[model samples]
Target: MRIRRVGAYALLLDCGEDEPDVPGRVEAWRAELARRRDRGELDAIEIVPAAATVLLDGVPDPAATARSIAGWTPRPAPVRGTAGVVEVPVTYDGADLPAVAEHWGASVPAVVERLAGTEFRVAFCGFAPGFPYLTGLPAALALPRLPTPRARVPAGSVALAGPYAGIYPTASPGGWLLVGRTGLVLFDVAADPPARLTPGTRVRLAPA
Candidate 1:
């Protein structure tokens, strides 16, 4: 890991080339930073994670904080349980489910099974609020976004693009292939954190 300043109050941790397991590494760093923040070791406002880097915001001393994190070894995150897990109940009936199954040479039930069986980790949050880019879809199941994005994808619409699976927190234009729908409210302004699927959270899709 390498740290560089992103201005005066922000620092970015570059974790080298992106890999299948990079999100886990980023989560480890984010958790450690949160611990330090709680202990008064660092003054940070936000710790945002992405595919290959962790952004530290509101840092009082970027250089010193960077040096401290560099010397610290990241610990392994919890592999199971509900510490950071979000269980989303899904209805596996989607407009593109048939097409997706055809693309994978699998039956409809097989597609749902494959998606529900995998464990995903939120790699980042972008494109829309509360919309997490989850990583963990098997390579055999990975596919590209639609050539023509829909003018507005419905809220709670579960979609997949590239190697990521995401839910539409609110109705908006999107290109990801719709695979399912859920009833969970992904974003609630009244909630403490707003976004239900924060970066580093483990996500599971359950048939409802």
Candidate 2:
């Protein structure tokens, strides 16, 4: 854990060498931070988890906060033995599907089959609220972001970038290559848990 001062806010960054043991580390930090915040030991205004780091905003003192976190050991990783695995139905008719297939030296059907064969876990939510960063995309399908970002990608648009896959939680500009679309609502403000794809939750994509 490292702490830095940014203007009026103190940012605490946890590499979580072990806490976020796997791809879903961000969610572990989220739940842990919530517990600390509830105890009033720390005041955390915002919790942002990315591919590699968890940013905690609004620590009164950076030096003291860093000392506290560094001295304390993180708890065990969350157990998902009882967590539900969410399966989403997708139509493999995306504009970039064929291009991606060609890039991988495989047919479109082959690409789809590979994608559906494995299960992925939600690693974190970023880029947009409720937008999940999923892990476990096969190495063969790993691809780069588009050279040109689309002005707007609709909600539930399934996209691939590098070794990760994601579903757009809301309409937003994105550069990931679209592979399919799902009818499932990933983010809904009115729902108890706005983002359906929480960390630790498993996701299996299937043909519509």
lDDT of 2 by residue, 1-208 (tens): 4555666665746565565343445555556766777898667687666666667787777667667766655565555652577888998778899888988898999989987876887877888889888888755567989998999998889989987899998899999999999998888899987888876568888888
TM value for model 2? 0.75
- For residue 56, what is the lDDT in candidate 1? 92
Segments in model 1 whose C-alpha atoms lie over 4 Å from true places: 18-20, 82-84
Error of 2 at 118 (Å): 2.6
Please provide the root mean square deviation of candidate 2 (C-alpha atoms, Å): 3.8
Candidate 2 stretches with Cα past 4 Å from truth are 7-9, 14-45, 60-62, 73-82, 138-140
Tell me the TM-score of model 1. Answer: 0.92
- Candidate 1, 1-208: lDDT as tens digits: 8899999999998876656566677878888888888998878899988878899999998888888887888778755766666789999988998888988899989999988988888888999889999888776677878999999999999998887899999999999999899999999999989999887778899898
Q: At residue 63, what lDDT does model 2 achieve?
A: 69
TM-score of each prediction: 0.92, 0.75
Query: Poorest 10 consecutive residues of model 2 by lDDT?
Result: 17-26
Model 1 alpha-carbon miss at residue 10, Å: 0.8
